[model samples]
Target: MRKLLLLILLAAGFLSVRAQDVSLTKGWKLAIGDSAQWASPTYNDQHWQAVNVAQSWEQEGHPGYDGFGWYRIHVVIPSSLKQNAFLKDSLRINLGSVDDNDEVYLNGKLIGRFGGKTGDIKTGSFYGPRTYTIAANNPAILWDKENVLAVRIFDTGGDGGIYGTNFSIGMADVMDHVTVNTEADFNYGERNSLSKSIKLITTNHYDYKGKLAFKVTDPETKAVLYEKTNDAAFSVGRPFTYSFEIARLEKKSYTIVYTFTDEKSGKEITHTETTPYLLTPYPSAKPKINGADVFGARPDHPFLYLIPATGQKPLTYKAQGLPDGLKLDAATGIITGAVAQKGSYPVTLTVSNRLGSKTKSFTIIIGDKIGLTPALGWNSWNAWGLSVDDKKVRISAKAMVDRLSAHGWAYINIDDGWEAEQRQADGKIIANSKFPDMKALTDYVHGLGLRMGIYSSPGPRTCGGFLGSWQHEDQDAQTYGDWGIDYLKYDWCSYSEVTPANPDLPALKKPYQVMRSSLDKINRDIMYSLCQYGWGKVWEWGAEVGGNSWRTTGDIQDTWRSLSSIGFNQDKAAPFSQPGHFNDPDMLVVGKVGWGPSLHNTRLTYDEQYTHISLWSLLSSPLLIGCDMGHLDRFTLNLLTNDEVLAIDQDALGKGASQYLKKEDYQIWVKELKDGGKAIGLFNLSDKYQTISLDKNDPALKGYTKFRDVWQQKYVITTGKDFSAKVAPHGVMLIRVEK
Candidate 1:
């Protein structure tokens, strides 16, 4: 009886040591200003705003506010917990995280300090875990009654106050004594055969003496692809790495399970992790090539003609064309590089994956440079939508010539809504009633020394349900050239409906190829702009299909979310931009823009407009004005007339800006200029004003440099080692740095 009682007591004691954590997410009272009296336990805080401990005070209606704030909360010590001998002696407090810096107080006594103020303001780790112990020797802490907890926070900029989800206040040994975590080497890939390294860990130094088992199961079928077991023991401070090898896996998500079973107690525990293997083209129908029976290519300039082919990926490509210096990429079916010879070269292109193989014949006609430096133009979609007319277009052309032509704004693009509802009997699309005569309108615009552009779609109807060049690519191209249209905006609208279940390379490339072939047959040199809304990563193969520029996103709205989303997404598309071909983030939504019959000023703020223009310029996107040229405000005119600012967009190097420095809401974009200079845009996307500084010591900047403010159009200040600027919300500071 004595032995049994001892065993029972030992088990009870073991369970009693488990971690008991108290969540401090609720009952927080926040005050905007700092005060020493607020830290007192008897101080009244009934007028303070209620705020969650897991979110910033800035998110709770305190926009753009920075500086000191105080938060207080009441935590009642339960009778059962206060009497506990272990917790009565020592208590551990987990404050989660505090922005910039913070100081904690328990019952009016200073308890802990994480960051800030040791004479000068010192930077604190924003992500560092806040775990402090209240030594059992402290006499201020009340154990038998309600306890007061207070925190003083300081925010330098952006979001301020305690935030994040891992907040908790608890006693020592109140958390799980043992915790398991797993880590893997490779979680994503397209390899047919590969090996993975995995590591397993357990906290609290608990020795795991058990039967270890490993299994890989398909997520869809739950079929076990691999399984293994071993008698193993894991202990803290010991290496625990396991290697798993797979021969091949179909393209899909898979679950990996690792289970441990104790041999003595029969207790079982399991841990799971997920990973995926992506195979190209995926399994589809048989492979086949789709394009014109004959194609054309030019010499001396870059030419891209994607060999459109449908079916499975891992597709092998081979071409019989004898054009010197030009070759086809087997993986993407894109034939690129400058053609050395101008003569007609009949080529047979073949594509084959594991499924099947097919071939097609085409021709190449290489010509002069298409897009020299990203096209500087004006698009009508933003200003007028489908309410455009011949008169509105002519007025816009006049405005461009009078107000912006000298600033290098040339192309005057007429977006959708110009086409009639239906095509003629001969399959030729005609202008709508608003556009009386297309040829006459083009001629009038051309006489003003401005190029005229037209819009169309590969589908039967456009976004506005207007006539499109579906089966009339050849006829439409001839007609457009006859009308002297200098550019074409080809949008993707209803095309997806009539295509195959899953669009492959051939399906996407066929329509564009048809237009390219048609344009090649014409005498005029038309700049092609693909408006496919970035589907299929058009930047990779857009130039191959004769596109001078391609839309990298859907559309841009006059809002911060729209501007930030479209601008930041261009980070990945920079690699594909070059001298002739560029990435387009829709049209610039600056100045006045609204659907016709009710036109009004743009909804974007003054600062946001500057950011929009700066980001688009740095992104190497086409600077197409999406606003009413008929009514220009002085501010709008000033925004558009800065040649120095626009010069960055027209840089001859054709390099897009890269985000070299990103910290919270502040981003520094740098673009290499043709003259060995660099154009930098210091942007603040947060609601609060932020001070941005960069020094010569920064790895991104090398050697001594001079600076010019592109927007202010003057050199404000020069610094040898560092430079700083206080920027407003959604504002951009455009600077040109020269060595």
Candidate 2:
């Protein structure tokens, strides 16, 4: 009995001991002033103000404060806390994401530092998560006593301090052997399985021999669909990749569980993917017209507008009451010619086939403004990145003409990497060898009734280290104008290389102003786009700098987290948007995206994709598709070609979505339309299906009792004062509310 009791006690002790993390999210003392002596553990912090370290110091009553700040943490480390960790020798602290830069100190010694300004650029890893691991057996650690941690931070502008969620310290464990990408994949091309890439970690010293199992179950039925087990081994510097797939999935979700067991340590790591793949139903074959109701261009400039329509093949097109200079091709739906008149000429556009006929009233607003509404088109960055070439661009243009142009998709904007390695001695930038004939490419796009756009930087080099405008802003502008470029994405990349570090607002606006001046001198109406990642609140001064659109955030990635954060956080910049100017939240992350030569299916689920399109339309953001046009599937095409959704974005009022109601489980954003109606996006932010109910008399509903389901294209009758919907998780129900 004693032997059994001893064994039970040992097992209990072993079970109690684990790679447990100690949270340091709360109870941290902070001060604005910085000093090196504050790093010392013995320093008196009795008078230091107590603060929580979960978010920016701005929210902690330090609003409008910028520059340097310091934070101190005090905690006790028990010797028994490291018991069950196989690699208990090392300690790790996660401070999450800090704006700009930071330096971590423990016991008066610098343990780690991340991101800093170099040269004139105020460079920092503001968005990168911060995780630092202390060396094994480091003397700076107080094993069974008190410890003091000091963090020094610097913010160039805007929000600052220790921000983001992960804040904990834990002993190193042997099971940190793999990282499974949480941004699950969906069907696009021939491949039709929900997949996740599990990469074996090669940073630790221990080798891991384990059994890995993949089990998939019907989320609603709780019945197992597929199961598999495999013996796996991993070691330092060993490359490993594992993927999971389940065939024959329906519209419903599937629960994917991955189980990994270590043979020697007896540790098991399990990951459950509650819902993975989703497929948006394909559109019907009936005729439908898509695109902006209003089109604008400078008088005498080549006017090109494709009657964007979707339906059966061999569709016929016609325009009634077109101006004398305008002409349309009946079979191709292409309108070409220039309007010398400087006035609004209303035209009735019609498209028909054997299946059905559709007609819409479109206005040819020939005047000074071009992008009166946001530009809907495709860019090459997320599709080809620096590998964009003439052949690839031509292929994209052909594909856009074949499938997308009929849906109002336009510009074939070539992103970075088109610049030549050098400029001519006479000072003219040229395209690289990949694009031997730039003007011809532009002409080809224009011939197809599509516009062309190009990218450049205000610094000595672009983001891709290619030639930039620099002192030759006018020269480059003239070159783009001569090349028939209709839009300019002026990236503020290496411009920091020319200016001083932590430049003032004037210096920040200088480069864009210079380019704007150059563009004004040119005869073409080139739409100016400011892409400084929202530094200095660009939305407020964007139009002042002659900008037609300005990026309001950083680059967008194909994941639920990236999409939700960027889309939902647009209220701050929405008010600044209006006609001929818009707030760009980067490009769309749908379709096949890889940011390189190779591409794969996007990591966003079907529901999240619906939310993405609906939100962007309501925000009135410039819709720039960031996927390879040659690889577009039916679902992505549906997401882009929704005429009603596109109308919200192309409204003549040019207003963006404003958060009307927000709660823990859901949110409703409302956008005003030109027709006195309102577009509302009912979004579910929870992890499970939620029923969203709203009163018809709500101010956002504008006393409207009748509504049309925009996506479903059906009217929904509400008998009572309230209307409701059973929204899927990460899903959206977009509707047009009217009397």
Clashing pairs in 2: none
lDDT score of residue 325 within candidate 2 = 88
Q: What is the C-alpha RMSD of each candidate to the true structure, in Å?
A: 28.7, 8.4
Q: Write the per-residue lDDT of candidate 2 for residues 137-254, one digit (tens) a residue.
A: 8888887788998988875444567765567777756655343334333443234554446654445576788888878876446689989888877777774567765556665556
**For this target, which candidate reaches the highest lDDT against the unseen true structure?**
2
Task: Tell me the whole-model lDDT of each prediction, alpha carbons only.
Answer: 0.69, 0.78
Q: What is the lDDT of residue 177 in candidate 1?
A: 35
- Positional deviation of 578 in candidate 1, in angstroms? 0.2
| TM-score of each model, paired residue for residue | 0.52, 0.78
TM-score of candidate 2 on Cα atoms, chains taken together: 0.78
Best by TM-score: 2
lDDT of 1 by residue, 1-739 (tens): 0000011111111222223456666788999878899889999999999987666676687753556788898986554544553435566666655655677889999887765436322232222235566765577667657888998887644356776555555455422232234423353334555466755454544566767789987644668999999776666776456777775776334667877676754545666655433211222357766433333334554444445455645668889864888877776556666666656667877778777787766555454555656777788877787778888898899887666664567788998878887778988878879998999998787666667899988877665556778888999999998998878988866565466634677787778888989988887768899887676788899988889899877556566876887797687788888877899988888777764534545657667788888888887788888888887655577677666677788776788998888888989999988778888999997876677889877765666367777876667566556777777677778888877
